[model samples]
Target: MNYNREDELKFRFNQFIISKVTGENKDYYSKLTIEDFVDIKNTLSNINNIITYKTTISFMDWLRDHFSYVDENYEVYLKDVLKVKPSVNGYDIMVTGKVNIVAEIKCNKPINNGFKYGSAQKNGIIKDIQGLLEGKTKVNFNPIHAYKFLVMYDFGEHSLKATEHLIKNIPSGYRGKVEIYNDKTQLKIDKVYVVFIK
Candidate 1:
């Protein structure tokens, strides 16, 4: 099936996953023809949906480790801290226990073959940032102390573009004191860590 270098690599990787899984292949990826990839690519939702879902799952796995609290109230505390469900505030994840945390997952693949954001994507990022840092919500939640995050999915080498975009376009109120790509593991406004997981 007419293959380019990239397609060949992906096909080989898919084969490897199926082979090494040892039993049942949990991967949703099938032995796709080049034509099939092209078809799926045309419907961006097909790809984005998968990426977003997988990213969320992976992030949650990491987060559970990060929190490392066996307490069931971590769930209740997470919501009580937020005073609203994620669906209400459009947050992707929130956890409260040893430390409060709120994150927005962005599984957007870069457009223009680089990191430039489409209008809607840009708007969404800005909104999430405002919501995270500025506490834009009807709820009584104060996000100032929480670890705010904009967890972006990097497809290939697009993450740097995200870093660059954020640096250039940090919301006005936070622009003067923003820190990024420093020795510090997190971005922040003063001492408060606003982690940008790229």
Candidate 2:
């Protein structure tokens, strides 16, 4: 059969939305908006590296699709576009050829029924932090700019808690250099940051 992934994704999104929105008055519709629905829908597709936003999800798309209110101060970096696709060229998103404005995207469900991140999940997140701080690519990373995002697909409260917990174990060496948010952190132009999306 000739398969069209975009059509399939749209079907899945519609089904998911229908299941979610069918129950009752949208006033209490999971307390989320239409944009939230689309974000979550695309997030699943993007994580799977499907049509719209792939694992190789680009700066253009990320900027256009997601909004970060990770902190009030982070307003400066919010939605600004980079001319090139940094993450596509490398493993994850980077604002420049150097280590300015890096990002790690995670589309994981909070493990063990949303209580927290499992051991493997924690380790994977740590690895992303590691790669962001120290680029795994052939080129050496020297963070010359600000902001590093650990973008988590908002999978409800459990996922939020899990993300907060992940920040606690940032391997000390990176503890000083980077500014990651559990609840909040002082925004800096010289440090990588974190943002959550769904």
Position 48, candidate 1: lDDT: 60
Worst 10-residue lDDT window for candidate 2 reads 66-75
Off by over 4 Å in 1: 1-49, 70-88, 176-198
Highest-scoring model, lDDT: 1
Candidate 2 backbone overlaps, count: 3
> How well does candidate 2 match the true structure, expressed as C-alpha RMSD?
11.3
TM-scores of all predicted structures: 0.58, 0.52
lDDT for residue 84 in candidate 1, whole number 0-100? 37
**lDDT per residue (tens digit) for residues 9-118 in model 2:** 66665666567766432333345578987887777754444421333244334543433332332333333323334345344554542224667777677876775888
Position 135, candidate 2: lDDT: 63
User: lDDT of each model, Cα atoms only?
Assistant: 0.60, 0.57
Point out the worst 10-residue segment of candidate 1 by lDDT: 189-198
Task: List, residue by residue over 69-132, the lDDT tens digit for candidate 1.
Answer: 6144455644443453325554666665567777767776667777777777777767777777
Clashes per candidate, residues 3 or more apart or on different chains: 0, 3
Clashing pairs in 2: 146-189, 148-192, 148-193
The Cα error of candidate 2 at residue 130, in Å, is 1.0
